[model samples]
Each structure stands twice: as C-alpha cells, then as structure tokens.
Target: MRPTVLITGASTGLGLAIAKRLLETERYHLVLTARESSLERFAEAGLAPSEHVWLRPLDVTIPSEREEVIDEIEREGTGLDVLINNAGVSYRAVVEDVTEPHRLAQMDINFRSPMELARLALPGMRSRRRGRIINISSVGGMMAMPTMAVYSASKFALEGACEALWYEVRPWNIHVSLVEPGFINSDGFERVRWTELAHLALDRPSHPYHRHYHDMTDFIARVMHNARPTPESVARTVQRTIERRRPPLRVPGTPDAYLFDLMRRFLPRRLYHELLYRSLPHIRTWGPQAQPVMRMAPRAMR
Candidate 1:
C-alpha cells in the first residue's frame, strides 16, 4: 500500500498546492480536510474527487469532529505515514481590544487543534516505527508583531509544543519538522472576519488607539494584496522537507525568514523590541481617531 498522508487545511493555499504537487507524484494516498464551505471553491478550481485525494469536511477546532475524522481514518485500515498540521488563522487584533471569545477562537484553531491532532496521531505513528509530522508555522511564531498579538502568541505556543515533541518522539523514529513561512497568499487575511471588538476598535468613538488600529489594518490589507509569496513556493518546500533523509527540526520559508531568525538570535532583546515597535506605525502611537492609511509602510515579517 502507498504511504497515507493527511493534510489539514488542504482546501486552499499552501495545503492545496502541496496536495496538487503530491498528486502528481502518485507516491501517496492523500486525505485532506477543511471547512465545509471550501468544497465549492475546491471543485470550481478543477480538483475532482478521486481515489488519490479524499476530501473531508472538518473544522479541526472541534474535538468531536477531529476524533471522528481520526476514527474514520483508522477504520479505513490505512496507516498514517505523515501528518501535516497546516490549518491555522491569524486575527489582526491588538492586546487591549481582543475579546475573550475571539482570543479563544484564535487559540483553538491556530494552536490547540494542532496539538490535539498530533497527540492523537503520534501513538499510531510510534506504533508504526516510522512516521512524520510537519507543522506549518509562520514567522509570526518566531517574533512579536504590532496588531497580531493573539495570532503570534498562538503560533509561539505551537512552536514550543512541536519543538518539545521532537525530542520526545525522536526515539520512536517519527520525524517532526516545522515549516515556517513568512507570508503566503491565502484567504486567512483577505477573507479575515474581524470580531465585534475589533470592529469597535477600528471604529470606536472613545477608542484611545483608533489611529494605531487603522494604520495596522491598512498595512495588513496592503500586504495581503501585494507582499505575499506564492503558495507553490511553500508547497515545494514542504515536499522537499518530507522527502529529505535528514530534515531539520525547523525549515524557514520566504526570502528573509532565515535572516530574521539569525538577527533575532544575535540582537539584544531591547534592540529587537525597539526595531519592531518603530517599524510598525500601529505600535508607535496611540490614537483617538482613525488615521490616514500610510502607503509606504514596510513589509512585515508575516
């Protein structure tokens, strides 16, 4: 039997591109999951139903659904050879304005679900004596940003969990790798639905930080439009990571991701924080009114 690979968030973006690339190889059976809403888009994009690509409706944030998905995989009697945790979202919210519900949602989708999925998949992979877990993290995981505090925090947690799991599972011949992308073209931003508090923060009458919020949102909107790397680039990297005999514990994607990583390592903590604060218009000021969008804002780490 071919190796079975399960990829979360495969309905679009990097996950979808990876699925397409792997399908061309015909070396593995693929199981993919995304929200039910993505099916039409996937179909419209010309990905037909096939024995090679099995699509399942899953919102990984829900525990019962995750368990059911795993159970169905088990019942198929196909051993999972690789698990790619790529399902995540970033909410553009400041610390002060992020509501409890929104914060929980971000945490559930970006960090908690990945950990739970790994927890469920690891035992089976260990029993098999050979398996791989590739987590699709972001540069946001490595450093802090201005408006995406909650998102960054979640990714940070994910990075910690995966790094710790690497040592724990190495004895079982299960390779764990983290793929961190700087910015990829995805609906996570374009289709980002802000929470009520975020809306209030953006359009608040008494908002002390309105200008900062507006500037951050403007920068994010522009980045989403023009500054993203191709999903295919990320897909190729993920494929290479899986095929490598000695894949590193972490793989950084995007042009300057490695450079940024190095700088973070060598720079003084205060200096790094200062650079981040000064670079983002949102963090440099507090405001009572929405400010004009700045067109020359520098590209973020994403």
Candidate 2:
C-alpha cells in the first residue's frame, strides 16, 4: 500500500511544483487540494485521476472543508502519512495601514487554518505512530521586515506552534519541519495582490510611511531577481525532506533562505536592521518624508 500524502495549495507555484515532484517519485499516493478554480491545473500539470493522485477543491480558511478532507482520508482506511500545509497568502503594506479584517484574514490562511487541518489529521497519524508535517514558511517568519509585519506575524505564529509540535510529537515518530524560502520569482505576489495591504501604499499619499513603502518595493523586487529559490527548487527540497529517514527540523528552501537563516542566527538585531535599511534609500522612520509620495507608483502595484 502506498503512503498517502495530503497537500494544500496544490494548484500553482510551490504547491504545483511539489505535486509534480512527488508524482514523479510514484512512492506516495497524493491527495492534492486547491481553490475550485485551480483544481483544473492539476490536469494541466498531468496530475489527473490515477491510482497515484486524488484532486479536490479546498479553501483552507473554511472549517467545514478542513474536516471534510480529513474525513475523506479516514474513509480510505490507510490514514494520512504526510500532511503539507502549503496554502498561505501575503501582502506588503505597513502595519499602520492594515485593517483588522485583513490581519485576521492573513492569520487565518497562513497560520490558523494549517493548525486546524493538522488537528483533524492528527488522530490518524498518532494512531498509526508515524507521519510527516511540513509547513511552507518564509524567511520573513524569522526576520520581520518593515512592510511585512502582518504576513510575518502569521508565519511567526506558525513557526512558534510548529516548534512546540516538533518536541511534542517526537515520541510518535511524527516529524514536523518548516521549509523556509526567501523571495521567489513566482506569481504568488500577484495572486495575493487582491489584498490592499500587499501593495506599497502609493494611492494614499497623505498616509504616513508612504516613502518607506515606495522604496521597499524596488528593494524586494531586486532581491527576488537575485534569489535562487524558485517554486520548483523549493519543491526539490520538500521532496528530499520527506524522503529522508530522519529529516532535520528546518530546511532552507533556497540559497537566499539559507543566508537569511544565517543572518538571523549570527547578526545582531541592530546590524541586521541597519543592513536592510541601508539597501532602501527612503525607508527611514515615520518622519517628515512620510508626508509625500515622491515617485510614481510602480505599474505593477497600481
């Protein structure tokens, strides 16, 4: 009997890439889920109905859907051997401009929903005495940035919970790991742009911290271009993490992710902040510069 693996956000970007990699292995039968619209992408990616794969529509933010996925897995009788919590959303606005609804939405998708799904999958995994839980987190989870407070907070919450879960589940031979990736050259930013918070607050020029938001956008775009963590690359890391006899607690999914992890571990808070700020010209404190939006909003953000 093939071990069953469930993957959230399996329609595109990292999720699609991971699905492809796992399917190639033929070692595990995958239960892949995404939004209803994205479910078709599985067929496009060659993950059609087969003994090796099962595709379903899942919006992780919904509680009923979470229960439904786990319950369906139980009906199969084999139980879940691996759970990949890959569905998450992110935006890029300063915390000052973040509405309460947006903050809760971010937490729900990135942090809470995964925890809830894990709660549903745990009983089967615990009864079987073996499982793998992998979360696709970000470097920002460890090192928060200026316009990334809300997104980072959600990831930080996930990392904290997973850290405790790692210790708690050791006795059951359940391995929990975080695959932290840096900025990737993927369409994920655009997919999440529907959120007002994800953009640099260029429209509201009167808003404080306008200059900081303006400058940081260019800085991150450049960083992503230089970074080597593509969706496919991260997928490779995820595959190896799952295949290992005793996987490490954390895996850096790209070179930049590895560097960020090192920086977070070795650099002082003041030094790290200084290095980051120096890269952006106008990203200082909320002083006089915040009163004006000097440059045009990037065409992408607009």
Candidate 3:
C-alpha cells in the first residue's frame, strides 16, 4: 500500500504545489486540509478521485478542530507516514505598531498549532517506528525583517522547536526537516497588506515611530509586488527532502537565502545590521530625483 501523507494548509501556494507534485508520483496517498473557504475552489481545480486527494476542512489553529481532523484521518486510513506543517500567516507590522492579539495569533497558527499537530501524530508514527515531518519555515525565521516582526518571531520559534524536537524524534526513526524559502509565491503578503491597510489609523496623530510604520508597510507591499519565488521551486525542494536518505536539518530554498546566511555569519553584527538596514527599502528613503544623483556617486561611496 502507498504511504499516506498528510499536509496542512494545502488550500494553495506551496502546500498546493507540493500536493500537486506528490500526486503525479503515484506512490503516496495525500490528505489535504484547509479552511472551508477553499473547498469549493479546490474542487473546481479538477482534482480527480483517482488522484487520492482527500480534503478535510480544518483550522489548524484551533485545538479541537485539529483533534477532530486527526480522528477522522485515523478512522479513514491505516497510519500517517508523513506530516507537512505548511500553514502560516504573516503581517506587515513593526513591534510597536502591532497588537498583542495579532502577535499571539501568528504564533498560534504558525508555531503552536503545527507543534500540536506533530504531537498528535507522534504516537501513531512512533508505534510504526517511521515518519517524516517537514516544516515549511521561511528566511524570515532565520533573519529579522523590519515589518515582519511578529511573523518572524513565530517562524523563529517554530524553527527552534522543530530543531530541538528533531533530536528527540530521531530515536523513533522519524525524520524532521525544515525548509526555509526566501520568498515564495503566496497570498501571505497580500493578506498582510490588506489587514495592515485596513487597520491603519490614518487620522491619528503622528508619533516618533510613525514614519517607520508607513515605510515598513509600503516596503512590504513593494516586495510582495516585485519578487516572489515560484511555489514549484519550494515544492521540488520539499519532494527532495522527503525522498532523500539523508536530509539536512535545514534546507534553504534560494541562493539569496544562503547568501544572507553566509553574510550573517561572516560579517560583524553592527556591520551586518547597517548593511541590512541600507538594503531594505523601509529603512532607506530616497526622493524620486535622488536616485540619479546617488547612482553617480563613486562605486565604493554609492
């Protein structure tokens, strides 16, 4: 029998791409879960019954809902062979601009829920003495970003939890892997923008930190508009991770990701922070006419 693979957050983006790729192989049965909102859309995507695509309506952030999903899966299948925790949320808010609830919500969805799901899956997997857990982390987790403070915190927490759990679970023959994609094609940023813009207080009196608030939000929007790594690329990396006999603890999905990691390691902390700040649009503002003048500066000075 083909091994059953359960993937959370499979409504779209990297999760959907991974499901699509995995289905083509004919070697694994797939169980995909997302909120009810995505069901009709996914059904319209034309996935056939023979594809072995089982859809479960689940909100991973809710403990009861997640437990129900686990129960349903157990009733319908033999046992889970792999679990991919891909569901996540992002927000374009600096630390001071964000609310306490928003930060906790991100942590709930991105870190805690995934950990809980993994906890639920362990008993069965340990009994079978085999399993694979692939965590879809981000470069944001490894490095800080001006606007994505809360999102980074959640992902960073997830990375730490997964890394430590990797050691504990290896004895049970379960392989745990983290995939950190630099910038993948997803609705994450758009959602962030919509929420931030909707919640922003336009008429409120400006404060010392208000300039940063707008710049950071706008920068996040521009980044979302300008560059996005293909979901297929991340899907391929995930496939490789699952199939490889010896996968590393972390697989960064982009050259930029690896480059930044190297830079963080080799550069002094102050120098790295300065360079990073200069590189990010939020921290470096230039007038429309300023670019041409700046471009003419000496190569080193520029």
Best by lDDT: 2
Judge candidate 1 against the unseen true structure and give its global Cα lDDT, from 0 to 1: 0.79
How much RMSD separates candidate 3 from the native structure?
A: 6.6
> Model 1, which residues run further than 4 Å from truth?
282-302
lDDT of 2 by residue, 1-302 (tens): 88899999998889989999988888888999998888888888777877678888899998888888889888864889999999988767777778888889889999999999888888888998999999999887887887778899999999999999999988999999999988887756554432464443565566566666766766676667666668988899999999899998888887877888888789998998889667565555455746575665454552
> Each model's TM-score, in the order given?
0.89, 0.91, 0.86
Candidate number with the higher lDDT (1 or 2): 2
Error of 3 at 248 (Å): 1.2
TM-score of 3: 0.86
Say which candidate scores most in TM-score.
Answer: 2
Cα displacement (angstroms), candidate 3, residue 249, comes to 1.2
Q: Rate the local accuracy (lDDT) of all candidates.
A: 0.79, 0.82, 0.76
**Among all windows of ten consecutive residues in candidate 2, which has the lowest summed lDDT?**
191-200
Which ten-residue region of model 3 has the weakest summed lDDT? 293-302
